[model samples]
Target chain A: MDDKVSIGMDSRRITTTQRETTRPFSLKRQPRLGESIIQGFLLFCGVLSMFTTIGIVVVLGSESIAFFRQVSIVEFVTNTVWSPQIDEFGILPLLLSTLLTSTIAMFIALPTGLAAAIYLSEYASSRARSILKPILEVLAGVPTVVYGYFALKFMTPVLKAVFGEANVNIYNMASAGLVMGIMIIPMVSSMSEDALSAVPRALREGAYGLGATRLETAIKVVLPAGISGIIAAFVVAISRAVGETMIVAVAAGAKPTFTFNPFEAAETMTGHIARISGGDLSYASIDYNSIFAIGLTLFLMTLGLNMVSRRLVRRFREVYE
Target chain B: MTTLNDEIKSGLPQGEAARRNVASRRRTGAIWRTIFLSATIIGLIALSLLIYNVVNEVFGYVATEYAVDPATLSDKPIDELNKDELVAVLQDNMRANAFRTLERDKPMADRSESEVYDLVIERVLKPQTLETWTLRDSWFNKAAIDAQVASEFPEAKLEFRSWLTAGFLTTPMSSDPLRAGVRTALLGSLWMIAITILFAFPIGVGAAIYLEEYATDNRFNRIIQTNINNLAGVPSIIYGMLGLVIFVRTLEPLTSGRIFGADSGNGRTIVAASLTMMLLILPIMIINGQEAIRAVPLSLRQASYGLGATKWQTIWHHVLPNALPGIFTGTILAVSRAIGETAPLIVVGASTFIVTDPDGPFAKFTALPIQIYNWTSRPQPEFAHIAASAIVVLLVMLLSLNAIAVLLRNRFSKRG
Candidate 1:
């Protein structure tokens, strides 16, 4: 069936070209078995994406309704404490922790990622770019689980050594957030570099022609031109940082407390879901449904960020064209 | 504009001022260049540090002492014991029900004498990990390690163990970090990847075909395109939620295989996880497929039509074959991304530890990332060592898959 559809779909390109040359084409042609099959298959595939969106919404909404029926939506959203074990289902604690970790990660990722991007775009020779890009990609490809392990085993020990044992907790958010920042560096760098390179050489030449230094030109001209794409990278990286699970699961303690300190261990939304799902919860329990509510919240946050990213990417494309 | 040296020195803007301008600009450029180079260096250093950290734990000397040496149980060497003798050793040593449980998990009748003997060694003659040394310390301080072992643990065995052994890849997860291996997890990962590819590939390609070839530029198609792009960036854990409510609960009868009497009726089966992964990666697959198809040149299609072949015939003969290589590259990358994905599987109920290999699509499963996560969560130092080794396995798989992607992309780019 797949082969037949591929053949059918590819063959259509030929017929369109043939029709243009032949002239006087009529719309009322007899339907064929093969053409109909290909069309049906393609349409089915396209519509399945819509089905996936519906599946996500229906599943999340139904379970969230069950949760909100038992726990008020206003409380779930506004309450500061999140002790499901004690029957207090406040989401603010988890939301705050997620924000804290993502913020720390961005603080660490943005300057380094942007600087690396600028370096690659404006300074590196082609040979240097070729060698460095693939290596950076390798860093991106390292599994998050490995990063989690590195956070727990390596980074924690190093931090303890630096701050003294009394200052650092075994499962602090600092290590997880820092390691996650490292994991996203390549992602931000490559993306911003892509944007920076797309900034027309004419702009850079115009700056240089006016007696501007390379530093002045890159900072004043290219950075401003690629600002939308750089912001998009930041949003995408933040979304990724918020959604990361294993690093926080292994290093950041599953305490889920509302706190402003980065050194203390606290659960993010993804970590909470992983922690709850790993335990054996009986079917249809409120605990099970609570993860769904959290998931719904998480889904909406990422969706908004992704839409912003998409808009930014489109703006970046429009700048040149 | 020519000026005397005295005028320029007195700060008239001329040759000296212009030279200073050029020199200062060059200085600024050099400073920025150094800064950029350092940024690249910092990234490279971090990457190297991670690899170094993982590799540092894969091989080391472990000081171990058994409760009762198997050597004392039999006059003959433990490995040389006959099947009946090994069974006698196990029965004599282990509690009756514990023996039964082992047999229940994997039947004794099916295992070789060596296999049962190894189990006896693992379960009955349990080796307690006394002290551990990192790969670096074990190499440089071998004499000190030996002296400490001799003073503290006279009866203990001090041996260098490479955690990534053939047996490690062949054995199952265990409570003891020394005996724990990744056989079950490896199989689960392979099963999940297989099903994900099977489901996502055809559907993703079909969608790309429709969008690139058949669909007219309209509101609906534009909306579909936007949704696909957004879906590509959706947090993977959200997909886990979708899968849990859809595959694991709502469609349990279908996913668990209870309708066909194949599963034990547990909704959190390999089939459910695989399907979740399929959905998670479908957007990436569709976008990649479109890119590959769009790369096919228009001249090929026109030439094929000049020969009077229909659309499908032209696609099959010219455009698709050219696009196929690029498509493979994209699929390979998507699969790599899917395999490394831990968040979705964790939410979809990947087990922390499962000792038995999965029986089929509907069987319970745990993957390598989950195992690595589980091991790292344990407080024991030895488990951290094992976690490091598991990371080596995961990295090898990810790198090889990505290498294939890079090679295929280069191959296709050359041809196209």
Candidate 2:
């Protein structure tokens, strides 16, 4: 029924185009004034998103400029301490912690997410896929704040038990990073699954025709073919990890320390912003301005990754089609 | 084909070697399959563990020590006391000056029985929780906890407490975790979300309509499309910064209701937060709305046009009705996302503690997630228990919203 309607619509469209060409002297239908006004209003609404982007850039840029005037770029980049109380503003510790947590998150999410994607796309029956997909979505739908609670109340204690109680701080990057990874798994699995499923069925058939096992075909041909999309998913997940605030804020301690140890409590850029802002700060103070600078840095990092991910996703689509 | 098969068979490793190779490969396959399945199971386990961790803290054994025992205050029981009796209990126990102050604040004669009862409990009984234990510990180590509590606080009374009680839902915020409830925060969240939907839905759908139905392949439209996509990926905190600079400061007169002479303190009003949230979720709404609008088949639009309907008429009459369910699903999902968002609202200056319920958009507000974040950060163990209870509330709210969206989508898909 639907196909027939579409076919009839297509024919009508063809006839209309033909009529338009043949009757060039006929009056062109003009939209009513009210219709044009509504269209204009809709267009404004469409362009409103551009204004939002401009607003974000303007806000971040202006505040970051003010922040940079007081603190030298070299000191901000290279100095180890981030004590806003003492007028010291170095971004290294926060940046390092952000990188550390994101790295840890990536380490957990990438392999597990890819394996889950491969399993769902290549192995799971339709009924299993239907059941499993929504469960994964439920994982994603859980609030970040809940994950923060889990990180602080649950993950930290478990981490403490495994690595002696003395070694793990009550609030550490490891617990936050691990929970953030769990939060990001659905993103990775879903995106990678889309990419894997988009790989043409003929390739799988050809591999099977050559006596290749399902596992062999999936690992060799399908994985390579969907590699770009999987990479894009990884990039997006990493960006999400880098930008995640609550879990890190709740579990990772507010102390800005340059430490490689995931067990040690250190603040990420996002966490620092959340923690400092949550406290009462006098408006336009150096401490307040410093959060904007950190936010600008985070925004740029995530934006860059998102752009790269978009390009990779686009490239993947191009290659397959 | 037969000759090629024969050639391939001749070239292959014969019988036992080939069997061993195939068997080894099969074993590896089975092992890898298990590994992959376990990865999925790990995700499921993590989710369950998260739920368990929250549930474990929400219900437990609590030991309380009061300044004056309720049994000593009432002939029967404190709970069974009438309003006048409760008021008398409060007037007798509290100082004369304090009693006058309470009367001055609100006359006890005018207060309800429960209100008077609560007042007596607050001013007279002053129940202070001495210690708390998790549900698991309460179940398995009951004797241990009992002995510890008995040794530690001989005068304290121990009882099982479900932190998420009706009182927990109705009572306002308090510094004392025992007295604190999510009433203010829940109202604030609902108010902000209601306003957010009002602003975001139409604008989102309008933007989507323009993009899907009316957009010509032009540079401006392309820019708008790309901007919306990028805006969705922009860290939510940046939007908070935008709200801080724009709605909170630059547009303070408008957001704070000063222009309207309402005397809201600042732009940290519910309206400000809702607008900020509107911007944050606008991209998501527009994207989802676009998908929903796009899903309204071309045949429907063409049929309407064939009947001499204008674009707007066609969209209103046919496309919108067909797409309503999809749009609802998208909006609910977006609203849930907005509801869960903590970072942006925090940056936009949600009050960490607010007692009075938000009565209007201009009022200062706290949200459930912000409350949870604040509670979890506190040093007190009792705060963690309350935070877990709040988490349960937030999760249930989000889950129900999601379930509704899922049901809508399922029904729509079935029909489509």
Maximum-DockQ candidate: 2
Model 1 per-residue lDDT at A59: 89
A1-321: candidate 1 lDDT, tens digit per residue = 999999999899888878778875665665779978988998899888888888898988989999999999999989999888778999999999888888888887888889999999988899999988888889888888888888988899999999889888898888999999998999999989988988999999999998788899999999999988898999999889988888888888898988888888899888999899878876668999999899899888888898888787677653665
Q: All predictions: root-mean-square deviation over Cα?
A: 6.6, 5.6
Docking class of 1: medium
Residues B299-360 of candidate 2: C-alpha lDDT, one tens digit per residue: 99999999889999998899989998989999999999999999999888999988998888
Distance from true position, residue A185, model 2, in Å? 0.5
Colliding pairs, model 2:
none
Question: Distance from true position, residue B2, model 1, in Å?
Answer: 10
Candidate 1 chain B lowest-lDDT run of ten: B5-14
Total clashing pairs for each candidate: 5, 0
Model 2 / residue A85 / CA error / Å: 2.2
After superposition, candidate 2 runs with Cα above 4 Å error = A1-26, A316-321, B1-7, B70-83, B97-107, B110-115
Model 2: per-residue lDDT, tens digit, A12-120? Answer: 8888889857865445887599899999999999989988988888888888889999998899999999988798899999999999988888888989899999999
